[model samples]
Target: MAVSYSFVAFFNSISSSYSSSFSKPSLGSLKPHYGLRVDSKNSSRRLVLSCSSSHMDSNSDTMDIGQTQVSSTAPFGLTMSEANMSRSSCKWQRVLLKVSGEALAGDRAQNIDPKVTMSIAREVAAVTRLGIEVAIVVGGGNIFRGSSWAGSSGLDRSSADYIGMLATVMNAIFLQATMESIGIPTRVQTAFRMSEVAEPYIRRRAVRHLEKGRVVIFAAGTGNPFFTTDTAAALRCAEINAEVVLKATNVDGVFDDDPRTNPNARLLDTLTYQEVTSKDLSVMDMTAITLCQENNIPVVVFNLSNPGNISRAIKGERVGTLIGGTRNSMAART
Candidate 1:
């Protein structure tokens, strides 16, 4: 599946409208007054109706949930030159973005912050425009952590993990909403069955979605207890055949010691699986690192707080720690 004609039209409308239409609005509050018009004959194909201006007719229909309505002319905040970059500039054709639950919380440790999610959506939009297939695995730590809450709340580990899985679903829905509100087409797939809200996780269907240029968000943490989202991310990456795992975090990269505790901690630009495990460095849980190492999947740990870092990482720029990348590949990036 290639980029649909409707999506191309939507992108063109965005490029033109931003240059001539109304002033800029905050990303979080942006509501373009166009509705998603799906051709019944081709249900798989999605079309985004663009709004010419900020003002819209009162009777005009707006976006509906479960449907994609792209309202912004310049939703990604990228210049024409940047958006027009060739697909060859993107190093990896398909990649998995592992977003922690806390990343969506902004400066706090609870709740979903719209501004943070909006920023993430923008970065994803930019890459999708360049023909990259993105699959995301988001964590539930911001809303719930089974391991921590289990002991404190006196709930069994399995029950607590189920609650945490639900938290990931909530985050996934919020992220999908934010992305689709812009010009990006997104789908939410849960590990367990939840047909009413999202598609059940199917490997072939997920690959089809990515091939069709839709960003797929995998929620529910592998549909099992006792496994972390980090492990879920690694598993999904291997299942989807993602070239790399882009682990977006608050920290700049992996450090020799805990950066928070050691002010003099040094950032490690590159490391092998052996070094990460032998050093007991917390780049990811041992399970995740082992999965990636065995499957030959590289993981890039980077600071999500920095604007454009997502784009930079996808472009193979040296923005953060690269674990499991070969010397030749690391040199090329530098």
Candidate 2:
């Protein structure tokens, strides 16, 4: 099905609001507070909203959870089972979701795909509702890659890397916008400062954002030229003290060889950090793999195209290849 015009128009109408929110240095700069306003005329599906701030306000009090104001529009409604499911899924308090640039493209030939973006936003919202604090690090290979263009262009390597960094910022903004449309609060922070667009990356502030249930998007690739975004993912994951790094990719899991090319190649359900690095596995860039290894952060490489896989990984359900960590003692039985 073709992407809906309503989705596009809704995003367009609020583009200025998002821009203003991120571009300014004060929360008060955002005139007319923005909130998720769902159009119920479409269907019964639940909607998620994204919210952002023009500035960081450390003094603001957290939203009260138990306070319920009477709404004249509708009567209260909730099922005990539904509430149980919500509570059970809230175990994961913090996570870092790493999405490659291609995942954002959806079915489009290039650039950001609105449908895919919205779908991801909704999935993130589902886990957030469960009380999981989420932070995202997105790649920019979909729009452009430094290595891909280096052969033809006269641009220096560092310049190309910087361009790639900027591309990530663009992707972050698109994601922030999409999430807000659904009523999910979000914050975009960059290693490189662009006051007109986002806040400068600060570890304390990022953690505070997560503490407030706000999804934080880290961009600009560590503010360095030689590093890949994968390394940035590792760095941010460590900085935020995330329990696991979910590397969402096209493949379901890591294999001894290219599964598509070698029929005998087997999918590795689990692996140790040393095995992955010593064997030169392609699960992630060597630099990123090394960083995760040193930090003892397990990496879960799974197919993002699979619906609900992100949430599954978060719940520690063993859906993908787990690398660079101590294996469970039950391995001897298996």
Candidate 3:
């Protein structure tokens, strides 16, 4: 009878052990020590283990349990660090970047400077790295300024402007080649048809290029005899549905007066489209400002000489003078 009792007791102990092993909560399903219940359906055991391991490793040096809880607030797929990193990385998906012909003249008397071209290319590449779609409208003043030359030589204004437009094409070729050299895909589109040299400007094609993250350089101005490249920039901005128009210039931002000539000149951080037109600010041509105002496109005037400003502007930073409708005020209030 005593031996039988001993056997029964042993069997009972074995059953209890098996039951405990099976019933014990899985670490993944384990509720927080507090009242919080773990969402087991949404997360797997492997993910919980990985997260726990990472948390432990991250706090190995410092035994801060609160940090781990803070890290857990993020969803299952991304850690707190990854979420913050993504927020910082977010940039404008579409932007129209206007680069003047004079900007292409990097320390040169006339025409395209290779160094300047490469510098601008590097800046553009940096923005593209952040996944921003960039469309460029280049001016032809570096190679030829129609107004100045026409005034001196008595050339017809329309003909001189056409010559200026052609100059932009040359700049576009140089820019395209430079950008391609740095492994960035580029497309050169001209308003004036030159099928052998470049694709004719097509609204759909330009939008497609931007969607694919390719740099679209619009050249030959509006293809009209009288329109300036500034006007072209505005037109492209609307067509491409860009969030903002980034006008890169020699000056960093718009000043109340010529900063170089007047030491007391104040840099305007923001201006309304109406104010720019009313004051007749010489930052962009009057026609360009009018188009931007009518279309409700924001214009950011920044210095191209400083590296990384273009990327900064596209990221929605206040690095330059912002000109547009009062719509931004409502956005800020929210």
Candidate 4:
């Protein structure tokens, strides 16, 4: 059997120091807050109506109820509106969006086009407002391609790759600025340490930021040479346990052939990881594909030029090609 105790009684029994911090509210004023389990016996429990003071009185020895600062009402400190939105509309709780640097150029000669960046920012912001957690991995091909630039610049391949990583940092900071302009909170985390500018990549910290409704941007392409941002995105996705990887590109989706070169190339709506590797498809680099395949993470390849595609992908709509682990499964069914 279990014994029932009033909130005031329980506090007094435990320690007199907490008595002032928690007040026993009237039965009519009780809110549906969380409960405290004091009884150890296996038996039914009852609610205790206790409310915290609006402001905690200064106490050196007494501590706050939750040291982690997580909300009692909502998980991850999400606002009530965001929590409701997530519960009602979100198909994927967490998502990783991969944007190629060239897509941000958007037919402009400039390496980073403001108009294109804003367009992408707006879409991402809208999706975020829907209470979905979004992490972005942006490429740097618009500013530099290490493999190609190394041959012409007479620099070592490793040096060129480092420069390319810096370019990704630039793009990440640029996108962060754009997202912030519209009242979205963001954090730029680099793989390698650059504490003067951005936070170094920490798995738990990044996950906490995502839970708090702040978008996290991963830069520096895994902090290594010879690894594309695609691989970085896959690695980040796996580390963060994101549900799917949204690969935003200029084309609608993966095609049987190079769409730009082959006029009659057909867009493949769905593909398995094995089929992609077997056919030598260009969905992503083989390393990235293998990483995602090993982890059973699905990759959604879609057009960034089209508005609402990002949101559609989050909703699991039929907007683009889905590369999943299953064989012969269509996007609509998957």
lDDT for each residue of candidate 1 in 274-330, tens digit (9 for 90 to 100):
999999998899999999999999999999999999988888888889999943354
- Tens digits of per-residue lDDT for model 4 on 9-111? 8766654433322444344343343324332232145223333343333441332343444453543456766667675665687999999998988886799
Question: What TM-score does model 3 achieve against the real structure?
Answer: 0.71
Candidate numbers, best TM-score first, in rank order = 4, 1, 2, 3
Best candidate, lDDT: 1
Which tens-of-lDDT digit does each residue in 1-334 have in candidate 3? 3568888898778557544533563544433221122233442321222122212233423232323544444332455576456545645578899999988886666577888889888888876655567999999999887877775667888888889998999999999999999888999999989899889999999999877769999999999877889999999899889878899988878999988899999988889988888898898889999899888888989888887788777767667688973323312310
Model 3 worst lDDT window (10 residues): 46-55
Model 4: worst 10 consecutive residues (lDDT sum): 34-43
> Each model's C-alpha lDDT?
0.85, 0.79, 0.78, 0.83
- For candidate 2, report its TM-score: 0.72
In model 4, residue pairs whose N, Cα or C atoms come closer than 3 Å (at least 3 residues apart or on different chains), thus clashing, are none
- What lDDT tens digits, residue by residue, belong to model 2 across residues 1-334? 8989999998978766554554544645644344653323432453324343554466533332335444332111334455446646543567888999988876657698887788789889878776678999999988989767765658887888889999999999999999999888999999989989999999999999998779999999899987988899999999999888889887888999998999999888899888888898887788998899889888888888888888877776666788865444323311
Show where candidate 3 strays beyond 4 Å.
Answer: 1-91, 151-154, 325-334
Between 1 and 3, whose TM-score is larger?
Answer: 1
Estimated TM-score per prediction? 0.74, 0.72, 0.71, 0.75
